[model samples]
Target: MTRTYRIAAIPGDGIGAEVVGAGQKVLQALAKLDGGFTLDITGFDWGSERYRRTGAFMPGEGTDVLRSFDAILFGAVGAPDLPDHLSLWGLRLQICQTLDQYANVRPARMLPGITSPLRNVEAGDLDWVIVRENSEGEYSGQGGRSHRGLGCEVATEVSIFTRVGIERIMRFAFELARSRPRKRLTVVTKSNAQRHGMVLWDEIASEIASEFPDVVWDRMLVDAMTVRMTMDPGSLDVIVATNLHADILSDLAAALSGSIGLAPTANLNPERSAPSMFEPIHGSAFDITGKGTANPIATFWSAAMMLEHLGETAAAERLMRAIERVTADAENHSPDLGGSATTEEITSATIRAIGLNAT
Candidate 1:
């Protein structure tokens, strides 16, 4: 029997639309190759443009609309004209919080034929999966402002941490680490400076560490951890951090591997309760909005992750092999990966690598 998975594609803002289109093309090609399952993609036009037109980034019933889908393939989300916070909180974070997507998993590894900025780093040397506490912590939206536009304006963006939130994410990270080959985990926090929330993270992490005896774990302050990632990336394996810290570190992780264009993130619910969201770690590049230069590998990789989450593991592995085949050829790569191929060229090459003609 052929299984059909419903996918909600939200190509929010700028280069998002372009990359999402590319991901859909690759998935379609994959479906053509393997007749075991099918993908039904429904695109949502909800972003800065929609906000400009309708005064809301997404409809008020957005969560209700998205709940039916098996998974979500997201493109980058940002705009030059709109405030970053408005677009972010209005869409991405809203979905994550509402759906209880607590695990933001980002994989940073040097793909085959891609050069790392770090010296003498091989393909297997700098592979790490960063697990971010997605639904809460610093991004819990527990802050306020007083006396705006005045000499004494005070703004407070409170970082909220709950026992439930901390423990679950810690256990998730530990389980992930235990599943991997190295069975190692790095917990990042600024507990020295942040005595309350970060300290609590450390405490919970320590408590959870005992449960996963097979997995070796360590803690690092967020600042020093940055240096460690750059200087000694090979030493790390699975990294777990707060929402804000992981957000910053993952971008650095992406860049260190080669380009932000090569990294994919999964905003996962992990309990099969609601739809998980997958997207490129890189943000919407306004500079490359209309240009055909935006690299589509990240989105392609993201699509693969979505497939794996949907339980189409064979299809996901095949799709990844297709991407690797395309990326291995210098002539088929994008400018970000030190080649000059356009997005369309990369997409077509990937399709060809999948043993199909782009239709």
Candidate 2:
């Protein structure tokens, strides 16, 4: 009675394909362990490249395929030639919003052998998660350009907020904070200025804080939050912010930790029947495509996050410990981590560290 989990594998454009290939290898290795479950992966060729070939990102009929999956393992999704709106909003954003994946969770932490650009910080000095409201706020596709043929043409994009969206994301953040070793939650908002939506965010965060009495809670304006992140990131645990704020803060957090190339994220629809989409925080690195130098740890850890989401916590922890072990070993690391090893070398080391054979 082995349970088989169907996963939608979207190896999007550029280095996305490269890193996702590595992630698939890692997942296969995990499946090979003495476990009661196996993975049935269905790869989706839907991205900028596909768009060029088919004039569509993801087919209308293909939505059913995505919905049928147990979970999704996503790669990056942008290209220089395509409009950012077409590459991101039309495809990746459509999937997430349509699926109601309201919580975007990104985890940034210093790896054992990676060094941060920040002064006086040792390896493994940072660990934090940014919980973003994914479905709404500034990301709500609500406005467009006006007077396109006139001299006074203006473009507008409306920012929206709902009580339901705010409340659930806040609750998710508090719950995540409780699960972490350091039980601290920070809410990032621009409530003083962006009164309509951010104020609601603040109100919801305050209400949620009362529910989680054991967790320490705090709030900061987005500007101040950025400054605090660089000066004292260790003091933070879980951070909840609107879509735009969270997007910016998470990138900063990734840099502070080590590299954006090492951060993993989960776009989660907690109430959905299907599992969430897990991916790395970095985008498709077209400049370095096929260079064999892209680091794959982020995608590997993202697979760990996916495992955790699937209730395979023991497997997830084991994978993470293996990642730590590999990173800690200076003799076997990718070039991005200051080692001379190639992508395949580092991935092989990670597999071996987890007691899996690199086949």
Candidate 3:
């Protein structure tokens, strides 16, 4: 029996449409190789452009449809011309929060031929995962703006943390640690300043550590984590932090590996009843949307993550190995990876490496 998966394809704004198109092709190629599964990609044209057209980023019923899909393949979100809040909060954040995708998993690793901006660090020496609390903490959307005086406005945003949110994300970190070779987890917090919320987070993380005794765990302050990420990235394996801290750290982790263009992320609901969303960690590159220079590797690797989440582990491994092969090939490379290949060229090489050609 052939199993079919329904994926909500949100190409979003700017280069989001472009990279996601590349990812879709990669997914189709993987499915062709597997032969037992098929993708029913339902395109959802919702983003800044959609907002301009309908005064809404997505249809009211679109949320319902999203809940019904097996998973969501997302592209970048945001446009230079659009207000950041309008594109980020109104669309991307809205869907993530509403869908209860509480675990944001971003994996950062140096690709075979990609060079690091950090001096003396060789390619393929960096690999780490940032497990971010997606539901709350700074991103809880709990604050408002107040007019102080003429030409002045005071904006206050609160970082909300509950036992429910803390424990789950902590457990997620420990579980992830158990799977990786390093078996080390770093808990990032600012307990010295924001005593209440971070203190609770530490206590919960300690409690969870009891369950996974085999895994090594340590705690670090947010500022120190930033410095160590650049200075000593190879020592870290899995890092777990609250929403805002993880948001910042993940980007730093991506930078340690290479270009933001190479990072991939997964927003997992983890309940198995609802579909999780997978996307590249990088935002929409409005400047390079039509230039053909945008790197597609992030989206390709994100598609590999989607395949793993969909229970097609074999296919996922094949896709990843194929990516590694293509990247490791000195002749096939993208500009970001220090080669002159365009987006289409890199993608074509990856597809060929996977032994999938358009028929």
Best by lDDT: 1
What's each prediction's clash count?
A: 0, 0, 1
Give the residue spans of candidate 2 off by over 4 A.
122-125, 356-359
Candidate 1 lDDT by residue in tens digits, 108-217: 88887888889987777799999999988989999899999999999999999999999999999999999999999999999999999888999999999999999998
Alpha carbon lDDT of each predicted model: 0.91, 0.86, 0.86
- Which tens-of-lDDT digit does each residue in 1-359 have in candidate 2? 77788999999988888888888887888777837679999999999988998888888876667888989999999999998888897678888888888999998878887778888875445678899999999989999998999999999999999999899999999999999888889999999999888888898888888999999999999999998888887788889999999999999998888777789999999987655799997899888788888888899899999988888787788889888888787886666666677778878878787784222
Error in Å for residue 84 of model 2: 1.1
Candidate 3: pairs in clash: 138-159
Candidate 3, which ten residues in sequence have the lowest lDDT sum? Answer: 350-359
What TM-score do all the candidates reach, one by one? 0.98, 0.96, 0.95
lDDT of 2 at 23: 87
Error of 1 at 209 (Å): 0.7
Question: Which candidate do you rate higher for lDDT, 1 or 2?
Answer: 1
- The worst-scoring run of ten residues by lDDT in candidate 1 lies at 350-359
